[model samples]
Target chain A: MSQHISFVQREELKNKPSSDALGFGVHYTDHMFVMDYEEEQGWHDPRIIPYGPLTMDPAAMVFHYGQAIFEGLKAYTTPDGTVQLFRPDRNMKRFNQSCERLHIPTIDEDFLLNAIQQLLLKEKDWIPTEEGTSLYIRPYVFATEPFIGVRPSKQYKLLVILSPVGSYYGDQLSPVPIYVEEKYIRASVGGVGEVKTAGNYAASMKAQKEAEAKGYSQILWLDSKENKYVEEVGSMNIFFKINGEVVTPELSGSILNGVTRNSVIELLNYWGIPVREEKISIQEIFDAHARGELEEVFGAGTAVVISPVGELTWKDQTIQVNDKNIGPLSQRLYDTITGIQFGKTEDEFNWTVQVDEVRV
Target chain B: MSQHISFVQREELKNKPSSDALGFGVHYTDHMFVMDYEEEQGWHDPRIIPYGPLTMDPAAMVFHYGQAIFEGLKAYTTPDGTVQLFRPDRNMKRFNQSCERLHIPTIDEDFLLNAIQQLLLKEKDWIPTEEGTSLYIRPYVFATEPFIGVRPSKQYKLLVILSPVGSYYGDQLSPVPIYVEEKYIRASVGGVGEVKTAGNYAASMKAQKEAEAKGYSQILWLDSKENKYVEEVGSMNIFFKINGEVVTPELSGSILNGVTRNSVIELLNYWGIPVREEKISIQEIFDAHARGELEEVFGAGTAVVISPVGELTWKDQTIQVNDKNIGPLSQRLYDTITGIQFGKTEDEFNWTVQVDEVRV
Candidate 1:
């Protein structure tokens, strides 16, 4: 064990599923990391326990007030059979930001990160090694105070569960058709849109289902105020290439600062690509498409990694990007990120946090 | 004890607390109503179970994607010692609106209302008869499917829990100091603000806490885009009395349609008072204050009924309303609404739905 963490193994470990059966967030590991927080006692009793159900009072504030936030990252099993996490410190930093916004107490990021590695060591067999497969890690915090009032909760629970899964979008990288929505909004400025809180995703589900019913993969959200400037596509930050210049919307305090978006930007800067985060409106994108300057469109997020937009339909005006194929830059970003993740390429950015090499 | 409803009595019900100890959403009744929903099976298995903790998977969608919505209404003990729910059908309608927006299934409103009455009847003794007290009924629905994906859950849990709550604010109709917020937003047009969902409240907690830290009771939000037009107050719909006329923000598809707000409007219309739902700007309110036309400001919702605003502090400018006393109009609205609730006056509008008093 890496620290003072306690573990209770399952009575009987179940057989692992066939590698082919691993999909996104459907299957879980044998154990999880659990901790609790109180206004007075602080976060205490860090332990690893058998994965099971959680018992909560019906009046838990999380059910009524939505005082919850979560972080999603993955643990990759490298080609040399070593397990590593991608930029876990960044996730922890972002996690604290969410905690601050939701009025939850902060935790020792290094302690929690070490505890995550320990929990992973306890169930390292669950890490999938097939091509494009790894264990998806979900570390989340939620209000546990048993009250229905509309105030911040004084008690909370922080849990980290591991799910061995395949690709987030599909079995392979694919360009998805997105519908530009002008009616419903995912978020607006001065809202809880800059963090990975549960409510932001809840607010976006309606538009997502509407787009899904129309055979679109996701909803391309515009700014809620004027509904002109692009905000994001589904849960991911968006990027567009026009006249060999890459552009995305500014943070604007209403869109999530996606981790993959940051990584992609870093990778773009490394490659000396002309990338800028500024206000890019839907009309501007359409104009670029009309002028043959729109080269590519893609989304970046932890879950989907890199998702290219095949066709964008705005008010029945459908247009294809890069001839309905993934752009070379998008493919390169995906390949380099995943290659570094799987240790197939050089770890030039020192992004991956390698787990301890102690044998089980 | 009711149609299509099963009951599980507690082996040893705890003694009821003294009426004086009843606080908001803290003290629960002995039992709760629960139902489950599946995409294929619809909502089924409605029953009443002993009040206790509910066991849910750690990866339940409500903890992750925040796919949940809730409604609040109160059951008043009349002077005749009979119970009545105030326009519960409106709450049911609003609940369905939230359900639709969050991609949850709607229930049979009449059936659910009847079930609520039955639940209240089973726990009738817990209903407080204190001058300003009632049984605060909370009916909530949440996504229950154990998955980490960001889509609506196929399985849902609908629960109705009862709490014997005292006054929402202080007793005796005290006027409160509200902060006029210009930084953080509650919701925007074309957003999920028009419904009673957890995310909408989650989106406001940050600003609410900020206002509270500044020594304010609640926040008075402005429009998200312009941050100019008055939207709604925290957890209530606000009304402004100016120059012998009453006005509230129109239903702009981003603020909750409070049942009490509707009743207040209807009550004003019945009394031949000039009332309108239109865009009222904060600057206009300041101008009205300057012109001595800002007569009174009160918030309306099912919990508090009517909360008078004594002062509003915006951008370091604190302006007192009605000289920091309850204005005549605010007092009248509170008195009339609460009077009808306690059966002190005639139910002219046919608002209260009298629960059938079959011998228990």
Candidate 2:
């Protein structure tokens, strides 16, 4: 695809926030990448414009029907000052998968990836250099059609915005308590659970809020049917170490296919650790813990690369894993993934895509 | 609940479309009612503004997380030259119910109803008086906070827009062919299926589109767990008549508690008809057809008060319902409902709320 990406520089740029003061998704870079799609003319008029408000019809379909999707990835500043993205291609591909499910028009993955790279280059200076901070890239698409009917929208807008963030969890490797939610469900089989759509996140807020009220950091969802089999966490894929083998729930139709989760599995296999994917149940985990075989539990996702699960409260029973501390394997996995992301370790996996510097 | 609605009329109103050309949700009235909500101030700044675009931050939470919900009701112009709304209170109550599930802050229902009534008085001319046409009123709420984190947004917006719409099925009483979907579940138990949220509608679009491509008007969704028992049709609650008894899938947690469905149940009881709400499996319906006891099937909702199901295609078998025509009972229910809405029949049920004229 030809790159006719237009640019509209902001007349006045806002001062960057201090790196130490940066929080997750709180501050945005100066410019954002935007593209519009209409039924007659496909996606066109790609541009990099000032980060500002969007003018939309009050009757846009997205407000009423929620036909929206988003991809989350990060851009990191290497020790040597090179900007690179962490497996952005996967995010782009998964974005199209979500589009297919939501009945939104799919975009050219390669073209969008290139657009993000260009967007990163323009805002490269905004990438934080803090030890635990990076630039969070949020690529989202939503229905822009000015109609109230419940159907696929004929118009859409895709935007890529950058936010400087410190870390998802205040302490990166600190283990957090998880509430095993039995009352609310995030998604179900034959539903849009596997896709990264807007609704999936919204559907999780109630449970998350309730869990937070109970002093839990996140929710560990169970299957909607029997409410027995373990599913993914609120925003991450969960894995457990039982007796020595690492096991995560298989990619059931209702679980998200996390890119970070995939990388962790590959790394585990590379390290020659025994790992398997199966339909493990909550009862089985409790049984394994009761038998003193459950070793560790953790979650994997982009925002929080590896979140160690310390305590789990299911129903009336609460169990602590690894003495309510980060397990050795969880710490190692976190270091390895962050090392790969920050370009400190060798890129043997060839996962990082370097963003080229713009030539004036 | 004091009335404090401020108004700003459009300088020049757009010409209204002809009543015959008034398709569903295509044309908007000259004005719309809007309210803003902040955590500290609660819902404030209720006003009627010109129907136009809304300025929203690009990173608004609704576009990314989809914490949105809406209610659909109608305003009708009676033959006596009075304007009234059908069950607006029920819609307001249901709106709060949806808010509770989405973790959104609830609003004052009585105050909102008063606001809508005042807004209707401003745009009463837009209400069509055609036999099958009426003003479609859509009241919606969405997250407007410009943060990208996956949590309940602190800021929100509520808006009510009016669109002059013709009959939902084009022909008011025409029967529509329904495709019984064994795949692509809409909502599951312990999920947000019962709420009139944006995600539920977006999640059902793919199934609806595929059914439409197969020459079906709407999809009849089965329960997500078993995919055997009937749940609902896309956008409407479903009912089946076998032998002499009318049956609807019970208000299973995943099925929407529709206003029209409730009214139908009440009317059936008033007429001394046997109606039951149970978990009626698709197999049972098919078996009932095989035994020559399947009498009729229809859908009920605000859009189509009584949509007779002419045929149902489940798996590979297609069965004609009531010889592909509207059932006598379906016709009577439609007449009773529309007659009450338009003030042509006695208001024995006290369903309609008359909108007072704007005094000069």
Best by TM-score: 2
Which residue pairs show backbone clashes in model 1? none
Among the numbered candidates, top lDDT falls to 2
Per-residue lDDT of B250-284 in model 1, one digit per residue for the tens?
A: 99888888889999999899999999999889998
- Please identify model 1 stretches exceeding 4 Å from their true place: A1-3, A169-171, A358-360, B1-3, B169-171, B358-360
Q: Candidate 1's residue-wise lDDT over A1-360, tens digit each? A: 234778898998877887788777888888999998888988987899999999999999999989889999999988889998899999999899988887778888888789888888988889888888888999999999999878888999999999998866555678999999988988888888889889888888888999999999999999988889999999899999999989999989988888888888899899999999998899999999999999999999887889999999999799999999989988899889988988898989999989896222
DockQ of candidate 2 compared with the true complex: 0.87
DockQ of candidate 1, scored on C-alphas against the true complex (2 decimals)? 0.82
Q: Candidate 1 lDDT (Cα, whole model)?
A: 0.89
Over 4 Å off, model 2: A170-172, A358-360, B170-172, B358-360
User: Every model's Cα RMSD, please?
Assistant: 1.7, 1.4
Encode model 2's per-residue lDDT on A21-49: one tens digit a residue: 99888899999999999999999999999
Chain A only: give the TM-score of model 2.
0.98
